[model samples]
Target: MRATEHWPVVVIGGGQAGLAMSHELKERAVSHVIFEKNRIAHSWRTQRWDAFCLVTPNWQCRLPGHHYPGKEPHGFMPKDEIVSYIEDYAKKIDAPVREGVAVKKLSRNGSGYRVETQEGTVTADQVVLAVSAYHKPKIPALANDLSASIKQIHSSEYRNPGQLPEGAVMVVGSGQSGCQIAEDLHLAGRKVHLVVGSAPRCPRVYRGRDAVDWLDDLGQYDLPVDKHPLKDGVRGKANHYLTGRDGGRDIDLRRFALEGMILHGRLLGLEDGRLVFGDDLTKNLDAADAVYNGICTMIDKHIESQGIEAPGQAHYRPVWQPEIGAESFDSVQAGITSIVWATGFTSDWSWVDLPVFENNYPKHERGITPEPGLYVVGLPWLYTWGSGRFVGVGRDAAYIADHVADVSREKTAVPVASRKETRPWHGLDGYNLASAVA
Candidate 1:
């Protein structure tokens, strides 16, 4: 007979989402156990580059009741500082977490769930799948075609430029990771070529305030999917390209051009012996500028509506270079020694035994999986723009905890007929569907 330890609730991940969920559960006086596949906030520990800091200001590092109490509110928090914050939060809250317990299986067992891990099995009435968005690094398929002599490392494996071979580095995918790695390599005295996509960019500080503050005040972070007028645009591209370096500084690709770094649009594919790029360099650059200018315009309106006196904001544009084509380059002719693929990541739901995902992503209104007694947190747009970020995830976590409390208080057992035939109930992200749902 398999030994079964029972928990009222079992939280799957130990990252920011999981920790925040655990904090809420403890506050509600709910009984639960947290299973962390590795140490707390493992991604922050292992995934980020050595010099990486959060793009969001320190004040936006809000999770539940915890706020950045540090003196530097406008400053960006570094990787180690984030890890330390997670560690301290776990300690202070006494988050009931089991480190190094990788959940091997999560499947429906009767009306609840049976979670099997390397350590043992846990039977819980509900499961909060707190796995974050990024686990695996997404290197392009074209990477395999690169010369074997050219060392290639995904941004996740990169610690510093010294870890790479001596020569110019070609950084691919101009998303957050791509841009940062390119900046890092350039600053390290290596020749850098940045291959950008249609990723958006914004100035770090606008109108004497951090760009995030402007977005935050304009409700960009809190708007719902339908309420957002630019749903197509929001869903079209990845998050805006900006950096948190040097106490919130703007990271424009054009500036990189001025500093002698070559820039390209999107990487097409490998030709005979070179890399082909698309002709959308100017198009992509324009998209980035639109995002920056759009936000500034919104901020300007907000200031006017409230009759608030604000300093005049300076306008910035990318400097065109006659020396650079601002386009394609053959890898060999470009003297590219290595390639850093900073595209993004793909989600792995193989460990889950239920069919709750669409396109490898958990399909739910928000965080809800059709299954009852189930919940998810920390997914992009799971609840709001801030769902995946630490700033507002605590709110979603609390919502889940409330639903769990309600479910636990009920004396009636869910009839086998009405329950989702496939899985169980996950704390859905939208309106407290629990009242109508329960």
Candidate 2:
């Protein structure tokens, strides 16, 4: 039998969150290993569309010691540049990562933990699951009912308009990806039909400044999840629909409607060779506009209260309105040959056989779980609004590292001879600390 490898700490991801955690662990001289299912920034490299770019500005690319090095701090980084930034950070931090090692299961082993990977089993005193909640692409069960010739795909698999068959495309879900992909297809001169959801919308730029900058200045990003208006409920909210493509601009679905794109209400599954939809097209559009205007109103208040000299702008008006859209339509008759389900994603935590979950979400205060030495990170609103983004993940990682260091110190205080024998604590003063210490 192969001997089980051991580490003081093991991180189970290689994205920005995992990399940031590794950087913090190294800062405290904590010996650890990072097991990556694929290469660093794998999702950014493979999942994103070809024209994808950061919705936030480049300046917010703060990952521990690394910051955006490009000249255009205000501009957005494209897909390739974003991947390069992550790769460079990994190199700069000198993170100890084992690529292509997919962790199969994580279960308790005495007081420590056991990590069974595709390559081998490893034991660690502490494990940090830095994998974000977006583990699996979520598609409605009704998608299985679609005709096979219709050529359906999730947003993650969509590359460009050219990849789809030559026909009008129907994109379901008007979240960030949904709206953006719809625009991408529409810009390519393909007739687009969009199913609008309740997801809100935000202006890319407002009153002569980026909305993100205004929000950052308003200290919105620093607000903790608990202190947020929605509290934990904020995590379930869909991201505001907007785009940074083509120098960044507002994604006005209303404007798109006027420009010949057909808009519908929420997708209500298919029946009798026709797509059914709710009569909430106008409602959804109005809700999105209300949010767009609400943000402008908030920024306006901030400007007035602070007496900042900035440009003034008027509120938006609806460019078009749906006049009782058909509740159902024959997609084949409408020439809709492709369906893009830009429906978001969900995490799969079934492998984690622990009592640390509530309603599929890992129960934790910040990153520390109720189970000692088991933690989670890279989750939206884990601590602050920035907890999962580049602007905030480093701080979250630092906080978790401090706690991990405290746990390490407590273990080190116990005499080596008093502990059970399992795996040697390599490169740490010749301590033969058992991996199964209780």
Candidate 3:
């Protein structure tokens, strides 16, 4: 524990969420410092493939009071454009972000948080954890069984398939990352195999209008948190499907899969460079349907219990299944030359030493941890109505910042013990229910 003489209202991460926190703090005239592990939006700059674009429309890109100034407001922005937007946003708002300063550990100290970083230690009356989702790439455990001659990489490490050895490549996971990367490889003129794990069949358009337009019109984006808890958990849950916000944007993956892409079952295991999976698609679909219905029913019960009104007539009906159950494929396949696991990510809180999480998940409410003055943003589903993921993170950040500000203003003499400790509140039982439901 290196000690610093002075303290800052510290904000962790320099991604969109962190920037949003800093922006909000500036508006409220709060003095703060943001510690960024790398360059701003470096994940987007480095993680996504070359052809990657925003799944949601540009109109939904606004953060708090700032709207994206562009003619193509409804169009999806590309990776570079998004990076540029964040860069420009930082400049425009003058966020106090210090790049290359990675916080190594954080702990409770007196009335605030003491953050230990590579640069030095800084204390703050409050702390905001804005580290984005997808911090660590998830590679399959069975990958080691494959021959060393075969190449394997998580989507995080993949820049282009052109770097791969000349042969057919197998991409595992059917979520947004997997689909997009598989599409890119296929269009790049390589034989591609996509291993279908789980998928959500999204309507390219809703009732003759773009899906995003419908979402905006229905105020789906404006729906308060606590309405969609399942979505809140996607940032952490492994088997969750990716729901594309981009409507009718034909990517090469969909086209190629329809053409020559060989679809396989979930990647179960590998033997002698051969990947295996169950061969029964129907049975798999049945199991997925049961789980999906269970979640939906649980959510409906929660809504009814809380007296939360359904947003509209377009409110969840039996037909509004956001995900398609994985069709059963109960057999294994051979001849896997290479495997690309685009399965998604997990939290990299290894450097964050705190008692705010149960199994690495923050024990908090809409980003407020049990640890007083410590908060979080950019979780999978922090509150409700799909607020913590990509399209929802900005609003979530705003809400969290509001709560943090509230706590800060009352910073006068309220002993830290007065605040709730979330860890014990959501004990093992609560954690089990949350993990299962999420």
Candidate 4:
């Protein structure tokens, strides 16, 4: 077999973005191969724990022409359901996906890209990096001080409360994951302890509506990350907290905390098999509340400026804000058998050899990177507010495909290997549909 096989494009990471890209390429009659490090929806299968559901509602989860199936399209779906949807998407569109093949290295070869994977090497005129931003977990160093008697797990390893010990549990990080996990454990009849930290809180519901409904009415979903002025200022500062019906009527964290969940100060350290925490639990919670209040203020301003009208302003209760720096955080040394770190994730692209990433982020105009034909998806902020990840990538995928087509038309030569000649099952219609948004 020759070292260089012809393909117009090769996409890395077979997750949502990669699949979407392939669908687009097909429409353009572009010959391409997708290299998935693991099986399709691998992250959904491994990283997310049991009882996990999509934060984005069902209708929003749809990609391009495919809408997530079944009724209640507005409700959240389980992780397994999402994984199945992705697999079905590949099968339905007949996407070219190489399962269990991890791309180890990538480099510029002449005017194209050389992708080295466990299966073999392929040289293509273009490459798309579709790996997600939350590829690695951040485990606190303080967790090491605890003796072997207690279990220590990063949020990535956590599935449900059943994974923890029977006694009191310490949930670190007050972000959405931390809050959700703490709530789950308490509901499972486990004595829970939440180590509070700095974050913005948003009510689970407003009056009789889900928070998502409010976001839709306010055009929050329409805000682009790159173009929006407010997203740039408070991009990753927000956290989800339910206060009313959705927050409490059915499932209440505050009530859970009142009954069994002991709110603790930030987990500072561990000494002699005992946990030591900051004495500022009250202050931290208060600060968290302040962050949330600031977000509501901004949203209100946006609603006014956009001249958007929402239904039932009376039901729109005041956004929940934790009292800043007002209370203290306490720690209990007994019955606490394990510590689950629910802190957020950090990116790991060390395996990706590229000079195009600025401060480890791709330097791209829209979705097109500096490297000719190189693209990235599922980034923290690729284009708009959530451009490269979640339900937002639909627009980003279209933007990239359109740019690729335009660039190709401008080029004189068809590169070393053309997709039309190499791949037998090729079509340009799907690619056109995906890129049509441009």
RMSD of each: 6.6, 9.9, 7.7, 8.2
How do the candidates rank by TM-score, highest first? 2, 1, 4, 3
The 10-residue segment of model 1 with minimum total lDDT is: 429-438
* Model 3 local distance difference test score: 0.64
- Using TM-score as the yardstick, the better of models 1 and 3 is 1
For each candidate in turn, the TM-score is 0.90, 0.93, 0.77, 0.81
Give the better candidate number (2 or 4) by lDDT.
2
Tens digits of per-residue lDDT for model 3, 1-438: 246634447888888888888887877677888889899989989988777777666777777556777888867788888899889889988988889988888887787777888877778888888886567776767776667767889888788877788778888887778877887787688888787655542333333444556434334444433433444444444432323324335332333545777666676674454445656433433344444444444344444555766542232223221132334321233354566888878767777677777876778876778887788887655654345544566666666666666666774533434644221122221112233233
Clashing pairs in 2: none
Candidate 3 worst ten-residue window by lDDT: 423-432
lDDT of 4 at 279: 66
Expressed as tens digits, the lDDT of each residue in 1-438 for candidate 4 is 256676777889899888888777777677778889899999888987787776656766756556677787767777788888888888988989988989889988889878888877888788888987777788878666556777889887999887777778888887767777777777688888787776546544444455556555544554545444443443455445542212132233345555757776766676564567776766666555554444444445545666766443331232333333333322334677887888887777777677886665567755677677788876655655445545667667766776566565665533423423111212222221111111
lDDT of 1 by residue, 97-162 (tens): 889989999999899999999988879999999997677888888788888889998889888999
142-237, model 2: which lDDT tens digit per residue? 888877779899999999999999999999999999999999998999999999999988889999999999878766666666655577888898
CA displacement after TM-score superposition, residue 345 of candidate 3 (Å): 1.3
The alpha-carbon root-mean-square deviation between model 1 and the true structure, to one decimal in Å, is 6.6
